[model samples]
Target: MADEITASDQIDEITDQQFLRAVTSFEAIIVSQIQVKNKLGDRLNNAIRAGIIILGIIAVSLLILLLTLSSQIGRISNVVGAMNQDFSTVSVQMSEIDTAMISMELRMKLLEGIAGQTQVMDQEVVAITADLETMRGTMAGIKSSVKGVRGNISNIAVSIDHMNVNVQQMGYDMQRMGRSARSLNKIFPFPLEY
Candidate 1:
């Protein structure tokens, strides 16, 4: 009985020591699991922060690009308006040019009519010059005939002066004869006056 009791007491002491060791091992395991969970949580937080920073940079770049595109579109609209105004000015100038061309065409037609009249006038002038040449030849013959007539008139004037001298001599002879006849009548005593 005493051997059995000593054996029973040793068994009880061995069971108490094993229970303390098991409790210590369980506490160590729980502490290690908590540390691992904390480390994972820290890593997750760092990743989230880095992702937020990258997303912010991308958003800022997109906003800048949008603003630049809007400004370019506004400038393009202004240029288009100016181009429309220039096109309107060009159209007005073209209309004026068309009117001028029409006026020039009418003037050209008038010039053509004047040119035809000038050609006819030139032909008439040439015909008149030919007629004048013929008249000049006839006038030359008339001038020669007038020169001969002038010489005949001079000869007739000289003959008229010679006849006047002879007439005066005859008148003197007649007067002498009339005096002789009167003396004879006085001697005869005939009445010649009756």
Candidate 2:
């Protein structure tokens, strides 16, 4: 009976020590789990911050691109407007050229009439040679015809002067147009040979 009681007391002591060891192991496991959770949370926070920074960088880049494009468009519009004014000037010059051409045509017709009159005077001089009795009257007619021809020549000189002035103005306008075109070529996507 004494040996059985001592065995029973030893068994109770072993059970109490086993229960203490199990409780300590459970607490250690809980502490380790909390540490892992804290590390994971820190990693998630870092990833979120990195993503936000990248998004901000992208947004700023897009804004700069947009502003540059807008400025370029505005400059193009101004250039186009200036070209329109140049074209308008060219149109007016063309009209002036047309007027000059019409005046030249009228002068050419007058010259043709003068040539006919000179042919008539030649015939009259031949008649004067053949008939010496009408020489005085023939001389008077020739003198008046010469004076008319001199007046016609003076008018022709004035008309030619006007035509020259108009032509020079047209040339000036063409040069201005070329300058505008050169400026406009800078904006083209491809290189211009001219």
Number of the top-ranking candidate, with TM-score as the measure:
2
lDDT of the structure predicted as candidate 2: 0.61
> Residues 61-172, candidate 2, lDDT per residue (tens digit)?
5565456556555655555555555456555545655554565566556666667687765665554444443434444545554555555455555555655665575567
Output the number of the lDDT-best candidate: 2
Off by over 4 Å in 2: 1-6, 116-194
The worst-scoring run of ten residues by lDDT in candidate 1 lies at 155-164
For each candidate, give its TM-score against the true structure. Answer: 0.50, 0.53
Off by over 4 Å in 1: 1-13, 115-194
The residue-by-residue lDDT of candidate 1 on 148-167, one tens digit each, is: 44544454444445444444
Pairs of residues clashing in candidate 1: none
Q: CA shift at 44, candidate 1, in angstroms?
A: 1.5
